[model samples]
Target: MQSFLQVKHVIDYSKMTHIHLRDFYASLNKKPQPERVKMLLNYLIEDQRRIEKILSTFEAVSEPYILDSWMQYVSNVDIHGLINNQKIKADISLDEITELAVKFGEVLVNFYREAATKTDLEKVSNIFKNLAEMEVKDNLKQARAALFEEM
Candidate 1:
């Protein structure tokens, strides 16, 4: 069984991943790019910021018992490796950037799903499931917005 600390560590890592992604998008925005691409980058940066805030709120308001709960299993998701694998370039195409953002969201969704299933506690499981759902919805919205921009 994994300790509560382990779960907290994963949550912290996820939060940090969003920060890194936000910074990456912000850097891309600073570079010379098509106006549409710049707009997309701005949306992505704001989305990441929103997600980071949500995670921070969860950390702040979670009950002590819920935070201390143990998990029966934990997946071996390599979040650090996933973050490091991003190959963003200043000259990246609009489609490429959109796809990359979707990929990042998908990774988080999978991670949350796995974490949800590994826990026996209903509250903990629900929290993870809810997070996964949020990511899925956000990804779809982002993809749709990009499609409209392309059209």
Candidate 2:
């Protein structure tokens, strides 16, 4: 079994992911882009903030035993590599932005799902499962918003 330190590391990593993603979207928003792209970026920024808050709640509400429990495995996703490859010019198209957003969502969803499977504790597993579900829903919402903007 992994040590409790590993569990803390995983939680910290998840929080860091959201923070980095939020900052990335914010940075993209600072550049001159079409209104549609700006709107999408704004939505993404807020979504990351919401998810980060939810993760914070998990830390606050979970029992000490749950938080201290060892995880079967920790996620090994390279968040930096994923974010670094998403560079776009100021004239980036709506499709390009949408594609990037989808990629970001997919990575988080997969990470959370994998994390859920690696935890034996029911509370910890459910936390990751719920996060995955939320990310999927957010992705769909963002896609619909982008589609509507195209019309």
Candidate 3:
């Protein structure tokens, strides 16, 4: 916790940007409707675009490794791959998948921040911090929507 707080000082994160980062992964499961799947994909694409824009914005920076790494993570996700082999006729509840995503979020949030702090370049550290914050905000949006769906 202390490490994250310390590392977070490297970048300016938009706390107001509530993104639904987890929804796309969660929608891969059997619980969400097909439309939900579409929504997830759209959000995912939007995030990708955001990352790209951020990268382009800082292309002139001396060290953009952190932004590069984040783009790799986003680009590496197998979007077409199905998350579950079993075909369920019913929609899977948000509760079923949120926990897994939240757990991943917790780990990633810490990992990126720690990684940033270890970087020698200030620009790299700042990008990592931004990436971490973006991930958190995006994931939280999904978690929130899921909770709303539950209600």
Candidate 4:
């Protein structure tokens, strides 16, 4: 089996995001709130697909460093630690899951927003802006839906 650093070295940002998300969502599978898990699962799956699309776009680009730099920048974010260190129990509430999901999206938004502002390349900046917009829109939609559902 590959070492942790070895596995990390081979995976790009999108893949890393996928791994983290999949693990987090899986943690909810055995929780008491099946309905909440089902609801969030839909979004998580869609999020992974969207990331794959973004990665494909990056693969088609001339400047390979754009994707690399974006990935490196995101890796520096603390969301990974938050997710990995979180302790989820079978009794965890939907509100807890919703909060974590919101924070997850916020981290992505911040990363992309920062990238958009920092990059000199218009292509890179546009990609980052688009991603940031997408993340914010989804986060808002999810939060509103969860609020209504909880009521």
* Among all candidates shown, the one with the greatest TM-score: 1
Q: Per-residue lDDT of 43-114 in model 4, one digit per residue for the tens?
A: 665665676666565566635565454322334465567678788677666688788878888887876686
Tens-place lDDT per residue, model 3, 14-55, is 211112333344345334365654454444446545754664
Off by over 4 Å in 2: 1-5
> Please, what is the whole-model Cα lDDT of each candidate in the order they appear?
0.82, 0.80, 0.48, 0.64
Predicted model with the maximum lDDT: 1
Which 10-residue span in candidate 3 carries the lowest summed lDDT? 71-80
Q: What TM-score does each of the candidates earn?
A: 0.88, 0.87, 0.48, 0.70
**RMSD of model 1, in Å?**
2.6
For residue 111, give model 4's deviation from the true position in Å. 0.8
Candidate 1 whole-model C-alpha lDDT, 0 to 1:
0.82
User: Quick one: ranking by TM-score, best first?
Assistant: 1, 2, 4, 3
Residue-pair clashes per candidate = 0, 0, 4, 0
Candidate 2: residue 123 Cα off by (Å): 2.6
